[model samples]
Target: MTERPEPTFDPRALVRSLPQSPGVYRMIDASGTVIYVGKARNLRRRVGSYFTRQAHNAKTQAMLAQVADVQVALTHTEAEALILENNLIKELRPRFNVLLRDDKSYPYIYLSSHQRFPRLAFHRGSRKGPGRYFGPFPSASAVRETLNHLQKVFPVRQCRDSFFENRSRPCLQYQIERCTAPCVGYISEADYARDVRHVEMFLDGDSNRVIDELVERMEAAAAALKFEEAAGLRDRIAALRRIQERQYVAGARGDVDVIACVVRESMACVQVFVIRNGTNLGNRTYFPKAPPETNSDEILYAFIAGHYLGGNAPPELIVSDDMTDREVLEEALGGDAGHRVRIRSRVRGERRRWLELAMSNAEHALSARMSTQASMDRRFEDLQERLELEAMPERMECFDISHTQGEATVASCVVFNREGPLKSDYRRFNIEGIEAGDDYAAMRQALERRYLRVKKGEAPVPDLLLIDGGRGQLAQAEAVLGELQLTDELTIAAISKGPRRRPGEEVLHIAGREDEYRLPPDAPGLHLLQQIRDEAHRFAITGHRGRRGRRRQRSSLEEIPGLGPKRRQALLKQFGGLQGVQRAGVEDLARVHGINRALAERIYETLNG
Candidate 1:
């Protein structure tokens, strides 16, 4: 088959032939990668201005320098172009675009409708389940707090369906009065349905309606001389009223989101305060990735498009900065939400107060982040000086081994960059086929596994590698790197405790050096190493403990002949725990579901031994 030829892209010729319509444009580099994406009302004027304008910002100039071709897609209106631009940016993640990094789905409170006794629980991800979802809550904690409050006022179940189905009697929730024990027939289906309705009304922001109905029920029960029933109803009404008072924003109603963006020292922070039906749900913060030249207005514009276009936009957005494309964004968001969405910068009353608060929070968060980044930079600079390196390292990795006696060994690799710990790049390895307590073998195995990926270009090679032990562990790392032909690609060092394994008294052993170096107790470079080393140790120990716990949790019954997973679960659930199962007689174990007498005898024998 013949290979397809590259398309001829002449910028001047393309600009002349472009129509004067609203559209989105993409800038491509020589490698055929999209470097930037943007939208404009007039395609010709926008595309022409790039080449005609003499005064461009540093970021735009840098982008222009790499542009080998320009591509445009026409639209009927600027709003359409705005939407298309957002989609392309999300899909392509062009290098120059202001991208929102936290795109995880927001949490919600789900009320199942498909079950006979509907369940209330915290939920995230796809809404395809047959349920009534009552939020796009700012965070999981917010959803959990709401669910907790609802459980206190309503006797609805929050347990998983499997647990709910297998119940032989009331669980802790029922004993604590948080659940009506529908699983054990303590409450009739009709009564449970009524409670579920009250929950739905409360979540829908009709707290006053729910309170009114509860008051009516309380009076009726009082008149009938049912003191206990009346008291419960009265308590629920009072609790709901208290909740409304706490959640209601003074002089605020309807659905609105308060958004504030602050840009400083080449970083940006966006604070979002979500309000639904006059109730303050909570606030969330985001740090979008952008260049230094991008302003708050541009960041706000990109954030609005990237965030709300997912069909979770509130009816009105109160913003801290005035966006140039507010009208276009409003149109796009409104179309997605099926309502008239407004993006407002100028506001008054409680909205002004909320906007101010959001702006203050954004400023505080950005300041704190920048302060930490500055500290990290200082530590990195000091480390470079101490190590006598040609330049400051961009990334560093530290390795540590953790185990108890000779069981469940684990090696942890923690990564750090100039901004501090890069947790996403941290890794843990289960050291297998080696002596249980062999630190050298564990280090060698982990380094080989990690650097093999680096050698194959699957993972980035760090500028420096640190070992948690002294000379022996360092030798393992050096040998591994030498085998992988990466010895010259990075520096290696080992940190050994000076005495009593105390902090601030550690000796550093650099590979290829004859003498060991110890930094002053207060040295910033030493502190940075300590931080990375401590993190690696913490990660390794955590992994080792988890592995050990899982291993111990596995019952000896698992090894018994003809004992399957179902029978094991049945025995554990019936007996409460492994010790309980172990103490049971063979005849008692035989009574568990799916366990025949022969299998039960085998289980009893194996567990006893």
Candidate 2:
């Protein structure tokens, strides 16, 4: 079959033919790249307005300059249009769209009583469907710290249900009095339920009431001559007080998310402080990528829409920059959170204080970003001058080989530019079909695989390439690039470890240069090389370790019937490790969650066999 010629994009014609309904429009540039993505209540009017006599901002005008084609996908409603718009913006990451780039889910303290003895666990990702989620904590470490305090005060079982089920004796958590030993039936359901209630009250931000209740219990235990129990309660009371003291600042007595964005030149940072039930939980800063001169409210709207619609459970009050499109954003977000949402930029007293705090955080983050960028710019300039290149490399890639005495041999490529390490573009190649300990062969293989794609126009060609080795590795790299016909145009250099493995004294080897030269230890050009080379080394080592760990962990457990990822985690947590599971008796194995009698016997026989 003959391929048809590609269709030409006529923006005016496309807009002229567009249906005036709720929809999303994607503007494709001449290169067929989606340069801009947007949603509209009326597609025809919206797309037509771009070409009309309206004053388009510089950013909008720039986006339109390259737009050769317009594609519209109609939606049933404006809310659906908003949803499609968000999905497309995230999926395509168009150059002209404000992309929300949060790679981590908010942490929540999950508790469910249906497991007999509720387990207090720090959770992130999808809910368990029935359990109560106590947070959307700013960081995982915050959740971990809070969990530690809860384990001390509540003494509720914090182990996995499988681990809890398999326990024939109290674990270290119990030995340290951090758990009530309910796994071994040391605590009754009624008493454990009472402790669970205390946890609920504390998490619900009723620390004062919870502490008061604990005081009454401590006195009662003292009157009953149970000093050990009374002492435990006293410690719990102290822990509660400590938490209360740390969270003494009380303002808004409702669910509120204070959001503020600070834009510097071309960078913007959005700071979010989550205030729940009158207590300040914590704050997180998000740097949303947008044109530097982008309107604050436009950035805020995109940030909020991307976040709240992208799985965050929205709060009652969203305090941010004064968004003119507040109703559209709220309607879209409210549909997801199942609540009426309100946006406020102007507030009085405590709310204003919180908003100001958010703004300060945003400003601080943006300022730091500017400083780092300035420093990096200077360093890149220094590197450009030292390298004597045709032009300053827009993107630099450093390669390194890592392994432990030839085992798990791997090579890594790390990319960077003026902005710093482009982690998303980093690549790792697992060396194959090569003799162990042959660094030259390993490097050759990695280079061939990487540049072969560049030769085929399947990947971007970096302006500069740095390999982590002396003359021999540099020659190998040149040979690979020469085969791909890339050496003549591409700048390649090599760095070798100093004698005695000293860092600053390392040598730089280039193709035409005879004598290897060394840069002053503090030179910014050398500093840049050191950073890129170190990053490549680190990436290779980390990948090698992960490969080794995964290979080691895929043990005899994989042979067992019905033992999957979750069950394996449970067994490991219960028995401590693979070796622990191997040593466990069939009875002990049977006690693991979801591990019944027959399956336990099979696991034991399979491992022991």
Candidate 3:
């Protein structure tokens, strides 16, 4: 088979070429970047529907206006298309897609079964080694609490392999009865192996079975005239029972994830309860990013696809509402779990009680989220009144430049909207190709690089562009925006510090208006502008300081006569951290790919000094 050619620039030409089979399609903008990704059973029909979508929302219209090309990858089945679509969305992070903001892997309690004396460790990321994993736990603190309890109950090793191998005697853990002390041969391998088995069983949602085993052991130890060992076993069993009692929530019948979403004024908060073996481990909340006019069904569906399609799929999903593509989701999740994963909106008995609780949590969470959002909306309203804007500005971006003695200069742009800070859109630019002290040149470079994309439809233009300086900075930004021909009716304003440089006494210089504006010391609108301008200042300083620090912190590697940038970078990468480099012996330094004995000795001495 031959490789498929890249699609043409014309959207219609690309859409006409799509096969009728199921696949994933990526919408590319004029700048050759994916702006949206989607799955469809019939590629031709789905790709064609976008062009024919009547009464499209503002977001959809903006997306379609920039469409320069289309790309398709065929899959054998709709389920396959769904999987591919999810993978692409996570990898590419298209703008128009419903983005899962917090995608960090959940923590787990892990047992290393392959070692001679296996260690009980807390882990996250891929669950792929020869071991048993006990959780997709809600938080690291929860995992830590469980780990601490297990350490007391099972007495497995928790130290790293390096420290374990180098032990000269039993450590504090062994003294406190939280470890078996296999590091110094204080516990026989056979005895430690037995304890490890009990730990594994306890983590595998069979604490009752482990408790029974402990009871049997305690009785046997008592019968054998071993009072202390029997007492130890008794304590372990008690700890297990206490943990189980504390965690047990009776409403959930089996291992399931209860997902409930509450929507208010086009905003959604999805609260998830992680239930395992009829026990409620804990819960989490998420706010997926999507368009305002989008339906809750679509939001929930997209969230499910992004959150669980190919990751951790619980045996049962008790969802709050029925989705339009419910069957497709169930089929996809079922395939992912290698079982029939049920998605239920309606429940009875204990499951119903759990669902109701989850619904309450979702509503409460949404109310709190909306309350914070409403205050931000009021700030925007106040800003509209103060600036005399033609309409309420939905997106505002502010710029500030920072440097110390005109060195390591940097510029930052921070964005805000009705919901508050859009931190994902914040950007920092390193000032270059100009005099270090020239604020005008730095601002001009930042504005050109940022808005040239918007001019080419690579980015969305904010309703207002704020400059954190006097008229000179504003003039520089205005020159760039004018050069780019941004005819989208954007407002430009510059804020200068007061003559005495006081916060509330600052002046606002709006482009095309002769007079400057100010407000009372306690005005909410003035405070809002100060808040944004201060954020831009803080962001710029952080970037500038980071850059300057790296330069100042450059180690003795640069001082050595033979060590160049390449060799220094290699050494840093090999050791990974400053402390690691400092402690690395000559032998360890010599083992790196590039360094010989002479250079290694020099590096070791230099870092040690």
Candidate 4:
């Protein structure tokens, strides 16, 4: 193998400039655009690793060759570097990085402690101000479920602290038996405080004690002949039982948090089950990205460190695989949670059983995901063969144009990388230099503009270009690309509306073929194309409808004959729209503030007599 000459730019100079401390590092291009972001324990040595000839892969080599400048932010510790890395990646969103881009903020159940009488509420984000925040729950419905259970079992008031303090009488919550109405002094302050304590206990996993108290209350109410009150207590007890019923996977013993991970190539799945007081709160699965060469321990170590860095850390974590630095992880999480934490591999007894179950789930989930991806790959290959392309189109770009009766002309390009739709790569264009309602012209403009960047090496060149149309539209796109001298570099195809828009009967337009090919209604390859085409149509239509809506907002019926501004406004205000007026009777249109009977009758007849 021939050795490539190194750049004269001194990495030692860069390393010497960096402080020998924990920090986050950035590799930037000549334009100062960051190509990759990394965290380092020792900034100099860590950044120096990229310059080493033996330590580089094709991806990292490509990243390094593009680097023109290095940026570093010194942190207090390696842990701080990790946190800063996640934050920066989330913000900058550099290429060659995997991220949790779901945009969903974890939910929490907060019990307000600021007022004389506390109240429970569902919340997301921080624990700022005064409140007892209980989750970072997986979903809103999960928080609601726990809230329902807490309200029934603990008698906690679900209201704002301000509302609780201002109440002069029992509210509807009291009538509905959802609350004890401590806001109106229906329950004594001490008793309410006791109820809050019980809630805290329940959340803290003292389920047995909480149940004992509820049972005692029920017995006391029954002995006093307050059977109605006793019945309410019975319901509370049943609710607790119901909660237990929902948690069917509860372990026999141990407060063990079982962690399992599955890895296939660069993709990884981490499953964590939190068992507190022998009840499984729940199990959550995380798909973390790791280097292919890295073993399970390193991945698991990094995963645990990153996972518990911002969330609640369990006391005892049992993993399916061993971690490189289990003690360091335990110490780090222990400091965060203000408790002694243990991270260990599977042990004997029920803890091991939980670990096995979690591992099983991880394996199944990973297998299913990989299977789905493989099927998509097979379909993509089949699509390429059917289209008779030189190579498979792993990166397909589909173009669609949407308009409403020659108004709000817009075009959209949806890019599908090897995975399903890369929504981030989707682009929308406003058509110009073309008549409105001219979909072929609009598509030509979009493709020309899109490929102009591809020629300049500013945008990725897709393996295949897909236009939503028949031969006429495809020819328009072909001519545009041909004029730009880009037709040979790319394969273009067109998808027209299937028979009666029946998905599978789609017509595929190829460049040289006189007649378009039709895929059978039942072919898997055809179904795949239909899905992609439908998604593109849906995306374009949505974009066009949004533009149309804005245009409509700026339009008025006064533009038509016999409709003055005032009368049009009156009609719109009364009937909402032409459709509404069409559905309305003459009497209904006449009921408008400014509409007379004759004009209203005329309007109704004009719409739909």
Best by TM-score: 1
Candidate 2 structure quality by residue, lDDT tens digits, 1-609: 999998776667787798989999999988889988999999999889999756988998888889888888999988888988988898899988888764546778999866678888767678867879988887554665677677768888766666678879886556556678888889899999999999999899888899889899899999999999899889889878887777655667777888898887888889988777777777776778897469888998888888888556445655667876677777888888888777888798977887888888888878876888767866876777776654456689999999888878889999997679999999999998999899999999999989875544346678789999999999999888864445644578999989988878989988877877788888888899999999999999999998777556566788677899899899999988787988899999999889999999999888788
Per-candidate TM-score against the hidden true structure: 0.62, 0.61, 0.57, 0.53
lDDT of 4 at 247: 62
Error of 2 at 130 (Å): 4.3
Rank by TM-score, highest first.
1, 2, 3, 4
Q: Give the Cα error of residue 414 in candidate 4, in Å.
A: 27
Model 4 Cα lDDT, one tens digit per residue, 127-242: 77786887656444456557666765676777655556777887655654567887667889998998888888777667668778889999999999999989987987787777
Candidate 1 worst ten-residue window by lDDT: 452-461
List the global CA lDDT of all models.
0.87, 0.82, 0.81, 0.73
Regions of model 2 farther than 4 Å from truth? 1-10, 102-104, 373-609
The 10 consecutive residues of candidate 4 with the worst lDDT sum are 96-105
> Using lDDT as the measure, which candidate wins?
1
Counting clashing residue pairs in each candidate, in order, gives: 0, 1, 0, 0
Candidate 3 per-residue lDDT over residues 308-376, each given as its tens digit: 875578888888888876777888988987878778888888888888888899888788767786567
Query: What lDDT, from 0 to 1, does candidate 1 have?
Result: 0.87
Runs of candidate 4 with Cα error greater than 4 angstroms are 1-8, 11-24, 41-49, 53-87, 102-105, 161-176, 181-194, 245-257, 289-299, 325-332, 335-337, 367-609
Off by over 4 Å in 3: 1-19, 30-32, 57-62, 65-69, 220-230, 251-253, 370-609
Write the residue-wise lDDT of candidate 1 on 1-609 in tens digits: 999997766767888998999999999999999999999999999999998899999999999899999989999999899999999998999999998754468878999978899998767689998989999998665776687678879879877777789889887567557789999999999999999999988888898888888999999999999999999998998888888888988888898899999888788999999999889998987788897699999999999999988799988999998988788899989998899999899999888999999999999878877877767767887898888864467689999999999799999999997678999999999989997688898889999889876644456768789999999988998888865545655789999999787888899999999788899888899999999999999999999999888677674667777878887788889999787998999899989888888988888788787
